[model samples]
Structures are given as structure tokens and as C-alpha cells.
Target: MSVTAVNDVNFATQIRKEGATLVEFGASWCPPCKVLLPILDELSEQHGEKLRILKVDCDESPATASQFGVMSMPTVIVFHNGEPVEKLIGLRPKSVYENVLAKYS
Candidate 1:
């Protein structure tokens, strides 16, 4: 499936579902977040079997972001077995993302 959008209300349930999860804590208007969308979609297609990708709009889910101590606009957190395993902040090369997800996926 494509990347799923999770909000404040569904964050807990979604992250706890199962398997490896990469969550993008971002805002709609953030340029870096916008850029990451297509990359994430494409990456999801390639890694969907091993990963469940989710996106959360920080603007709409302030409490959720705050809970994660997300001080940046595009904080990507990788969760496996219901616990956070890795985190990446700011923009980076696609290979950088693929490398991280590859490790956990």
C-alpha cells in the first residue's frame, strides 16, 4: 500500500499495529516534507512488503510531535516491534533513506 497519513487521534494505534514503520513527522507547507512525499511513495512500493510507511502532519498533530521531541519539520522515525529504532532529520539523499530503511526492513 501507499504511505498512510496518521493524525493525532490515530497515531498510537497506527504505530502499534505491527512490523517495521517509518513515520514522517512533517507539515504540509514544509518544502522538505513536500519533497519527501514522492520519494517515500516510491520507496514504499519497493519496501512495502517489509515496511509500513506512515506520515503525520506535525501542524495537525502537535502533541504527537512534541511527544517524540520532534524539533524539526521533517523528522523521520523508524519503528520496529512497536519501538523506535532509528531517526533522521532534515533533507538528505534518497540513498541515505534507502540505507536506513534497508537496515531495519
Candidate 2:
């Protein structure tokens, strides 16, 4: 599955979709967010429909960021059954991501 961009309006919808959803709350200019893009892409391909990856731009959707209490860029939240199950902050290795999400997928 390809990564999909979400905004304040659609953030809830994306997170509540069937199965597990990984939402990255970030800004376009955030360095860590940029570094994570390729890793997420690779994982998306590997997981296919087992996982749904979504991105929310903090700059474009401040309310959504605030709702999630994102104090920093590149905050990744994993959601299942319409609720958050895991969260990661700042820069993280690809293995770390896989470890956090593998069970859910």
C-alpha cells in the first residue's frame, strides 16, 4: 500500500480504517520526517494491505497535531480498531519501526 496524505478533516477516517494504520505526524521541512519517508515506503510495499500508512502535515493540520499532542515533528502513531496502540517520537531506525509494528501487522 502506498502512503496517503491526510489532513485535519480526514485524519480520523484514515486512522479508523480497517486493520492497522500508521500515521506519521510531521512537517515537510522536518529532517527526521524526510529521513523516514523511504523507510515507510519500503515497509508499505512489504506489508501491502496488512498495514495502511498515512501522513499528516503538522503545518497543514495544526488541529490534528494538537489533538494528538504532538510536541515534536516526526511523531508516528500506530492505530488499530480505531484507537492508538503504539507511538514513536523523533528519529528512529527502520528496525525500530519494524519492531514496533511487526506484531500489529
lDDT of 1 by residue, 1-105 (tens): 789999989898887446789999999899999999898999889886788889999989999999889999799998987899898999778899899877776
State the lDDT at 27 in candidate 1.
92
Question: lDDT per prediction?
Answer: 0.88, 0.88
Model 1 weakest lDDT span, ten residues long: 11-20
Leading candidate by TM-score: 2
Compute each candidate's TM-score over C-alphas: 0.93, 0.94
Q: Report the lDDT tens digits of candidate 2 across residue range 46-90.
A: 888788899999999999999889999899999987788898999
RMSD of each: 1.2, 1.0
- Supply every candidate's count of residue pairs whose N, Cα or C atoms clash at under 3 angstroms: 0, 0
Worst 10 residues of 2 by lDDT: 10-19
